[model samples]
Target: MYCDESGFTGNDLLDQGSTYFAYASVAINHEEATEYVNNIIQKYKLQGGELKGRNLLKSTKGKKVIAEILSTFKDRIKVGVYHKKFNLACKFYEYIFEPPLSEKSSLFYQIKFHRFISNILYLDFVCRSEEAEKIFSDFQNLMRKKPNYLFSSSETPDMSPLDDIKTFCIHHRDTINQELNSLQGTDIGKWILELSTSALFSILCDWGKEFNQLKVFCDVSKPLKENKELFDVWIGIKDKIYFDFFQGVEEPITFNLSQEVQFVESDKFPGIQIADVAAAACAYAFKEGVNQNTESWIEHIPGMVIGKSVIPDESYTDPNTLDATRNLILLRYLAEKSINKQPLLDGIEEFLSAVTHDLNLNPSNRIATIAENSRSDAPYFNF
Candidate 1:
């Protein structure tokens, strides 16, 4: 299958003009994807270079082409969406990293995104500066790697790598700004990431059930380096993603990276183009706030969507605000068990306790045991 996203702003996720971020992916029925792409190119007289979604969604003819494409491939597409606000995310991080960084606010309360995000929060929000040199250190000396078979039973308490934070928050209660309540925070890129990977793994999970390997393709967002390839920009989901079903009693469903997944220019493959169309269409649907004709293109792209910000349910979501805990979990994007396909809401603790999942010479997945001294005013994050 192929996957791609619309409305990517890198760290510019909180820009208000970009209200929503979406990821869309299509299954790899190669012959059918090719046939559809050819029909669209011939029908629209599209020049051979590429058929990008943003361009295709701009014209009346393009709209017709999109509508027809939707009509043709509705079942093969999947989408996930998130609405974000950067300001709110900043505030939440501040509140977490604010003064009184002890007790519950210790290393136990947060998932550092496999050590990628803790410094961002600790330095940026909490106003602590010790190392401009070891800025790349893995935040925790985690005990294990990604948890695929850890949860053998639902009856097992959700003792994930992320459990420490949940437990700390539940017990300490006042470590963060509890009143700054919102379901999702403004860290839009992370939210986009959360949405994108979830979209991919949902397919991986279902395919895992069938014991079938699925290859993933995504549109190229970065300039291709001559010899090196960017790996797993999305954490938790590495070159491979796996999850155990049936309470971990069954063999885990596993998927790998690079060889199993390919990142390509949109022009070379028909599937990526369609995924582009589908991703943009999803962005439009969320903005329109209605699923009628203007938004009908989404009807053609079928897949589960998480973090739907359109619902008026303030009980959990408010497009205009930020909720402390949710945003924290979101920024890390590594607290859930992709291996067991377990709910990621608790995956951070597992991530905190995990180690050595990487199989290569370059240890990009840096992990460790870390417990910052919350109250020692000396600014201690001694690894």
Candidate 2:
């Protein structure tokens, strides 16, 4: 099953807006899925590690260890790392409230670092597509094997009656929040949320079907309401695609979310693929800026761009461009840190100029001139 989330983090107080959204997805077949849950019990040997029991990580140290082990295998883990970097950068500027290098009270001089490491990691993974294919092949093989094969005879019965293929798209908000509430620091919460988002994205890519045939089932929660803007953007995009794809058909495969989890016996709702949609959501979040109805931007941005370079294409919007743009704004806030501010300003000007050229913006000269004029405090200009 795939799992993902949006708006886990509260708004950015410094910017008076949220700077990050996170999502995670995971995928597993029936046998592997059963084994995964069962292994949690067997590995930890918990008193009540039965399938229906709530085996939270806090209950036991062994359980925590087991949870971490399982988390490493999740698809969204890398994406989680990226989100963590962004969150850390935000905290460094806001919560840490570190004084500016040169100025004691000038908050405007504080660095606003834009964390795009997650995108770089994603691009690296996709560039190494062969590895993904190999891992997926191994997963399928493992799924087909008998459940008992991985366990001793004493533990074999625990995995029996695992024939039914069930997929659940669980948002980790409640669990993470519960864990964080007991903790003393904000860093762990940031990391946990990042991990959850990455895992959700991974699940989506593995279990999700083609965009033409996809449905999402979710539990009603506050985060959903908080992130309604993002959802709306994505749904709007999906609707346009659906209309285009089924122009001649009387009815087309529609994408919608339902709170109801019930499905008829014959009904085969494809397993949840949270990472696929989470990646799409992240793409949209970056494109539309952090706001409600950000999901509408998802339709305009192609899913083909997932795990690809940040350079924009007619088919795929470059999330890197958006990230870079955000970073430029942040850099302006950091400009006062430089001993030679002119050189720093020049670098920023050159980078923005290149981007404008690449975007084919008409009146690029006018924009560059404005950027040039924005550089007023050049030390050499004193002569």
lDDT of 2 by residue, 342-379 (tens): 32233544664565565445344433432432223221
Candidate 1: what lDDT? 0.45
Lowest summed lDDT window (length 10), candidate 2: 160-169
What TM-scores do the predictions have? 0.48, 0.29
Off by over 4 Å in 1: 47-49, 86-211, 223-260, 291-295, 298-313, 317-383
lDDT of 1 at 142: 9
Q: Model 1, 1-383: lDDT tens per residue?
A: 78788876543433557766677777766677777788778877987556677787777777777787766667666666655332223333333333223333334333322122232333322233233111211111000111222111232224322333233323323433242233234333223222344445444444444334456676774421111122243223433344333234443334433253566877678888888887787777767755444664655444445322221222222111222223333433322333244443444444433422221222322212122112223122222
